[model samples]
Target: MKEKKSMIEEEKEDHLKSTKRIEMEEQLANPDEEPQEVISEKEEY
Candidate 1:
């Protein structure tokens, strides 16, 4: 049971890393179309 739990944890970590990597790659592949000012305005002042 402990071994299975460890495996599950590792898998979850791997999935998270993979997702973040993909997101970063996509961002790099395509330049952001939105302006920084617009983004800042939408966020907290």
Candidate 2:
């Protein structure tokens, strides 16, 4: 049972990991452009 559980856990995915890597690449490609997340956060203030 533990072996099966471990296999299932290993299969689980972390979507944010891929998103962050893509974000970093985009930043490197266009350092001048601001990310929308930062803009939205600033608007919250």
Model 2: lDDT to the true structure: 0.70
lDDT of 1 by residue, 1-45 (tens): 999999999999999999677656655665664344344565766
Best by TM-score: 1
lDDT of 2 at 30: 69
Q: How well does model 1 score by local distance difference test? A: 0.71
Q: Score every model by TM-score.
A: 0.67, 0.48
Score each candidate by Cα lDDT.
Answer: 0.71, 0.70
For model 2, the stretches where C-alpha displacement exceeds 4 angstroms are: 1-13, 37-45
Model 1 residue 9 lDDT?
100
Cα deviation of 23 in candidate 1 (Å)? 0.2
Best candidate according to lDDT: 1
